[model samples]
Target: MTHDLPYNGSASLDALLDAAVDAIIISDDEGTIVQFNSAAERLFGYAAADIIGQNLTTLMPPPDRNQHGQYMSRYLNSGQPAIIGIGREVTGLHASGRTVPVHLSVGEIKSGGRERFVGILRDLSEQKKYEAAVITLESQLAHADRLVALGELTAGMAHEINQPLTAIAAFSDAGARLIDNDNDAARTELKNICGRISQQARRAGDVIARLRRLSQKGELSKSSHDLQRLVQSALQLFDHEVRRSNAAIATHFNHRTKLVPVDEIQIQQVLVNLIKNSLDALAESATEPAQVHVHVEEEDEHLYIIVEDNGPGVDPENEPHLFEPFFTTKDHGVGLGLSICRNIAVAHGGNLRYKRSERGGARFTLSLPLTYIG
Candidate 1:
């Protein structure tokens, strides 16, 4: 049923359809292809002569092709549409047997006692490929970031484990002396020594676990996690080192219990790196009553994980390179702590940046997008 439909006063309707960017296809009430534009010809690799008068489902994949007729029948019978105004993402079959991702929108037209449905399809193959490439790039950057952090972590772990090993050695000597003495208090001393050894061993193991988390390689595992809990755990892991450095710590929570969806392990590494950098700054500075403060607050629909130090702030000259890869002021890392943290932050659709603390020290802020919780 070809109509002499007019477009403006000059352009023919066929010319307009052929000029359109999106593929346009018209089907009758019975779901037979009535018309196919040049764009549709290019999109599905089908000629208008071959496509018209055929079942419209020929362009759809298996299940959609099977169910489309029934859906159209239901729509016609009920005068209701399953998907009309809004578009849907579906797989379309090309004439060359290739499956393409497309966004499809359908519009209904009632003219001269006839009902016609028009479909506009947008090819999403390029978009899908681009997204895949971005994901792969992010994964690679994360792996490299972790590896750089691991280099610095190695020194920290060695220095960290030495204390626990020394304690373990002392406890072993104490247990042996208690056994040799064989006094009534010997039993209590032996139990205490055994407990001390277990504690020390666990301390060393904890360092290894934290380091492994950052250094492990794989696809990102993103999920909803409690920010407060992560902060607490990171601080707890550094408890002994903080105490050894005689640094006082304080924390403020929002009480709103902000939960964020992210790669928790990677984020935890970020927090640890920030804290470690702060500790390094504190150890090198002459600030009295060294203090490290962590605050978790929400502002502007963002969750901010902030680590601030009262130690000397970042050097004015090195500010720009602070987040640069392989830029380190220390003997251990390639300065990957800040770089990786920023990478993780960006990948999570958030940000990690450094600011000047009121105490004239470096403040690292990790801001994450807040999710809507129902």
Candidate 2:
């Protein structure tokens, strides 16, 4: 079983290394570069003759450049592995003084009792650029979706603000009338009217504030928020629609773990979309005494916000295309809501799923992990 290849000579090995598509570098135990293949020379902007015999650390960026020797020493002395066989993405120092993204794998070689190490590197700059571009596109899409949703809710938002404004106007008129009486009883009544006006003004301000927050276009910012409160806020946006459609809304919240880390605006957008969809479905079905229930529960280190309606559910054939972009069941729908919602959920290290409800209706569950990694 001791068969040796005819291409074992230095010249043949050099030719094989040069022919490889990925850059290959071989260094002695002391971290001195001994063999710099042509691919490596092209990747690092250094000629093989210039890089050979130099310290391997010369090719690394600072931080890594300063610590690579220590890493090698630690592995050689302790026989422990950090990234010897395990490959990972890292930054490479190019001769042009620019940092390049690369995936690197290292292996050890022992020949005639001397230890050497071989490193293989693949450029990851294009992959990173593509990923960043994708993130930008998703952000833009989510923002556009939010604006569309807000546009649809314009009527409800106007109704919400109008109620408080109407009350404030009535209270203000009564206060003006009492100003002419000047009696003790009239003065007391005037104070009560003034308080009512202030309260109504605050109520109107709150409605406007909620609308402003949801309609805002910006980057995804994560923070701790009460899930139940977020759901309630979203429901407020549909008050007029729910009343007009004669729909009954119910909610159950688990207060024990209601707080979660998420981009509040985006999460609220998801809630708004789901609740609106449920309301729309109920409206279309004309189900007797339409009912929509929202429940928040915590199980197995995950938080779930479930929205279900007692209306016509999705057809079996349409289930598979629910999350596809530009697919819709509505006559005037652009169909990006579910797709964007699912992307937001996944971006937060969670998920969105649909299922048949116990009451024979459509049910959507948004699950978010309690421990957020982002």
Best candidate, lDDT: 2
Residue 352: error of model 2 in Å?
Answer: 31
For this target, which candidate reaches the highest TM-score against the unseen true structure? 1
TM-score, predicted candidate 2 vs. hidden true structure: 0.46
Clashing pairs in 1: none
lDDT of 2 by residue, 107-210 (tens): 99988677889999998888877765675576568767765775677778889989999999998988888899979999999999989888999998998777
- Runs in model 2 lying further than 4 Å from the true structure: 1-9, 149-155, 163-374
User: Which 10-residue window of candidate 1 scores lowest in summed lDDT?
Assistant: 1-10
Off by over 4 Å in 1: 1-11, 145-155, 170-374
Looking at model 1, how many pairs of residues clash? 0
TM-scores across all candidates? 0.47, 0.46
The lDDT values for all models are: 0.82, 0.84
